[model samples]
Target chain A: MSFLSVQNIKHSYFTKSTAVAALSDISLEVKEGEFVSFLGPSGCGKTTLLSIISGLIEPTEGRVLLEGQPISLADAKIGYMLQQDYLFPWKTIEENILLGLKLSKRLTEQSKSASLNLLRQIGLIGVETQLPKQLSGGMRQRVALVRTLATEPKLLMLDEPFSALDYQTKLKLEDLISATLKQFNKTAILVTHDISEAISMSDRVLLFSPGPGRLHKVFDIPDVIKNLTPFEARNHELFPEIFQTIWKELESFETFKK
Target chain B: MKPSKNNADLLHKQYVHSLKREKRKVRLYQLLIFLLFFTSWEFSSKMKAIDPLLFSSPSKIIDLLFSKLHDGTLMENLSVTLIETIVGFILGTLLGTLLAAILWWSPMVSKVLDPYLVILNAMPKVALGPILIVGLGPGYASIISMGVIISIIITTIVVYTAFREVDSNFLKVLRIFGASRFQCFWEAILPASFPTIISTLKVNVGLSWVGVIVGEFLVSSKGLGYMITYGFQVFDFTLVWLALLVIAVFATVMYQIVAFIERKIVKE
Candidate 1:
């Protein structure tokens, strides 16, 4: 059985005047420990879909299933990190990292030691004293990632987290994330407009149609290697092929001006 | 030839920009203006156009200030006013900020207190001067109460507005983590509201001064406000001007301290 399942889910928003459909009968299955990417253009409902799965937004129709049972939002195991780091500016790196644990009331001495070890593994040692504002953009995002993952959710949602960074930093973060996720053995669903990013990071990239987004295609990436990071995979012979396929898939999308 | 001419013109413009007065030079020019202003006022009073008794020549006001300083009266009065203002300001800010937090913490509390607050705020707080004196008696308590009345309203309004204006996007992030309300406030609302809080502090510094001075005017035997009133009754224009100068100087100094604190926090 799939670790998590979304079966024909629909979502809409009513703006006091009209109902606007955001997701039109979307369905997908995420296996245990799978890295999934919801790839689409800006304004696509990939984020809205992710939100529904994360239980931040309620689906209008259909049900989300976890462990072969109907999933309540409260019961949905999700760790969502957004584009903005959302690191409390006042908090130190240690405080910010433990924010999730603190909120979840799971910050025992054992978890504290484990979290600190995780931080060290992620190459952030002695950042306990530094405030989020004091850290670089890349470092802030790292702290945010740690904060999200501290709750030890079964599935992690990445919402364009690296989009805010410049190119070099983005590449560096991709490398860091790959190592951390692999070591921790976490499942993830990444939402991104960046084609190359989706191709590079994800095990399977789910391409979606433009607004009222529905999954158009699912590309099973076969470029898996022993311990290849996002930066290292750029040199793979299949890199260009995967990028081109997803590019063509996106370009074929119908564009009608609103 | 046209291009060369334009380049020459550009070079000239750049040269002029480089030669433009520095910020410190602009400050010097301001000082000069004050000196010129005082000199002119002294010249005018020296002339018979306005009576020296009525206009209070800058030189005479300086002499009056020196004499008051020598007598230790100016420092004594100023210390009393400063203490009252500081105590009142701190108390008002603490009360206002706590109340704002309570309101933010629970909608029920906010709803209950809102009407009463509006009515209290709408009434001229200055009108409460007599009541404050009656309740607190004819001492520094009356002045501190007045200052508190003025400052607490501002602190409440500024903090309440800031409290309500919390970023909902952060709330969504918190919700995803199943964060409680207390945790959300600690992590998100408090830090986000800080810039607003600092700005309110700066504004309140001035308002607190206004409150203290007004309080003094209502009832006091010492302080700059009292001195001004005494001068006004006895027809000592120079003394009145001196008192005004003292208040303006003290208020500006306090405001600068607030600005300094803001700078430190911003750096942090």
Candidate 2:
């Protein structure tokens, strides 16, 4: 069985007068320690699908299974990073990072040390006492990632985590997240609009078409070598070929909608 | 090129000079206007243009303030009013915040109690003064009750709104991590709503002071409000003006304290 299975999930929103479908016929399985990117345009339900897989929202039809069992949000084993860092402005960096563990009542001396270690590993050592407002945007996003990772979740869902950042910061964070995910042996599903980002970091890029989004195509990178960084992937010889192909595919979707 | 650089330097210097002159002129104009008002008031009273009995001159008000200080009447009355204000402020804020948390914890309670809270907030608190005195019996209890009654409902409303307005996105982050409702509140809602809560405290500072003063006016043997009521009964307009000045100063000082705490919290 796949480490995480999303089976024929369909979700819709019902207003008092009408129903709006958000997602339909979404089925995929993520292998253990694999990095997958859900690449699509805005309003394509990329985030909705991520939310469903994270167990934050249940689909109207079908279900998600983690390790061949039904997943529950209350299990406390899914780390979902939102588009906004959502770092509590009132909390210090250290406090924010430890929030998950603290909420789960798993905060111990050992867990605290592990969180600090993660912070240091992510080059966020000195600002633990500083509040979220004091940090730069990129630094805040890094702290947010640390906060999610601190709890040692079995799966990580990154929902447009780097979208708020500038180009330079976004690339740097891509490297950081890609490296960190590997170092921790974490399986992750990243939802993003940026094609280069999707290509560089993901082991497989899942292209989603808009309007009640459904999976259109999936591209598995030719090689799955261990420790292949996003920067290295960008520099690969096949990078341009794959980039052009997906870029045209995405542009076609825009025209297709029009 | 060197000469243009020198010209740029000179232009910058001129700009700075003009800016400084403008700032100095503004400050001078403000000070002169304030001084002119006081001077005209004193001149008018001395020249008998306006009745000094009714509109006490700034100097006479100052003199009364000093005499009250020397006699310790101002100090004693000030302390009594301050204690009442502080007690009422603390109790009102704490109870209001707690009740707001309870209301937020259960949406049904919030919905059921919503209209009544609005009615209570809108009701003229002074109208409750006689009722409070009847129930609590004309002492610090009634006085503090007045303050709490005036401030608490507003606090509950403001805090509940803030709590509800806490970013749902942040709450989702906590929920995805398996955080319970209580954890979501403590970690996300409460912290996110902090600026609003502090703003509520600022509002409560004024409301609590007003409540205490109204209570004192209705039924109190001591306090600045009582002094004003007593001064009016004896036709001591100077005493009334002096008490008014003291209350204004005290309220401003209390407001500044709340603003300072707000600044510190926001800065952190």
Candidate 3:
């Protein structure tokens, strides 16, 4: 059985005048400890799929399973990070990081220390008492990552988490997240429009087509690139070859839509 | 590099000096306006340029204030009004916030009562003074109820809007942690709306004063509002002016206190 399985999911948003289908016939599976990327243009319902998999929204049709159980019943096992670091501005960094544990009623001495250790491991030391606004954007995003990991989720979702950061910060965070996820052996699915980001971080890149999004194509990374960090993977000789292949496919979708 | 550092330090000092100078200038202008208004009023009243009995000079108001203070009548009336206003203010804010919370808790209830809230907010609150006095028996109860009634609906609307306006993403974060609805409120919704709540408190201070004073006018038994009515009936405009000035001072003090609390609570 797959660690995470999305089986034939469909979703539609209804307004007073129209019912807009966001996703249709989407089915995929992730093996344990594998990193997958969902790459597509805007309106491809990448986020909609992520939201459904995370159990934040229910698909109009079909279901998601985690470890052979329904996703909704397996709450707190899924961690989702958004494009912006949506840390509570009112809360201190310590409170923000511990929020998940507190909400799950899993806040104990051992867990608290573990979370703080993760914070230190993420290179965000000595910022426990400071408010979110006091930190720079990069520091804040790192803190957000710590908050997500503090829950010790079995599956992680990154919805363009580094899209809002500068290029340098984005590259650094990509390496940090890839290494950390690998260390924990956690299954992760990253949704991104960035081709290089998909090529570098993912074991398999799932390209989605827009306009009632459907799974269009999948690319498997070679072992040479998969063994390297995201930064090194981006610089590998075969990186551009894979990038060109995916880029042309994505461009074809855009042209077909037009 | 050393010379540039010195230059930056010098520029910083000049900026601080200019800021202080601007603040001093503002204070000077405010003091000038106060002095000029009072001095002109006194001069005009003494010179009989304005009707002395109707306009009432600053001197006469002060003399009456002292005598009223000696007899303790001013304090008695002021205390009654202050207590009524304070009680009304607290109750109005609490009940309104509670109502807002209820509305936030259930979307159906808010939808059902939306039109009613709009109607209540638009209607003149003071127009209900006579009914409140008659129902609550022309006492502190009725007067305080007036203060509460006047501000409660608007506070409910403003606070409910604030609660709704909190970013849904914050709730999403909490929801992913398996947070209950109540947990979402306590953890995110309430704290996020503190600035709005504080601002509404500032507005409610003035609102409750209007309500209590109007209630007092209807009841006509005690309070600064009664003092104004009585002074008018007896042609004692000086007493009327005194009540107005006292109300003004107290209202400003209350507003300033709310602002101080806002500064302390909302760091950003």
Best by lDDT: 3
Give a tens-digit lDDT track for model 3, residues B16-42. 999999999999999999999999999
Alpha carbon lDDT at A113, candidate 1: 82
Error of 2 at B161 (Å): 2.6
Q: Model 1: runs farther than 4 Å from truth?
A: A62-77, A223-228, A232-235, A239-252, A255-258, B1-31, B39-49, B57-76, B102-142, B161-169
Q: What is the lDDT of residue B102 in candidate 3?
A: 100
Task: Pull out the clashing pairs in model 1.
Answer: none
Docking class of 1: acceptable
Tell me the tens digit of each residue's lDDT in model 2 across B1-268.
Answer: 9999999999999999999999999999999999999899989998889998888888998999899999999999999999999899889988988999999999999999988998998988779899989999999999999988888888988888889888799889889878888888887778777888888888888999999999999999999999999999998888999999899999999999999999998776
Identify the leading candidate in terms of TM-score: 3
Tens-digit lDDT track of model 1 for A23-109: 888889998878889998877799989888887778899778877877644542678889989887777888878877777778899
Instruction: Provide DockQ values for all models, in the order shown.
Output: 0.44, 0.79, 0.66
TM-score of chain B of 3: 0.97
What TM-scores does chain A show, candidate by candidate in order? 0.94, 0.96, 0.98
- Give the Cα lDDT of each candidate: 0.84, 0.90, 0.93
Give the per-residue lDDT of model 1 (tens digit) for B1-268.
9999999999999887766756668889999999998888899899966788888898888898899899999999989989998888888887888878888999998899888888877877878888998899978889988888887876887898898898787887788878778877878887788887888888777878888888788789988778888888999889889988888898899889989989888777
lDDT of 3 at B259: 90
**lDDT score, candidate 1:** 0.84
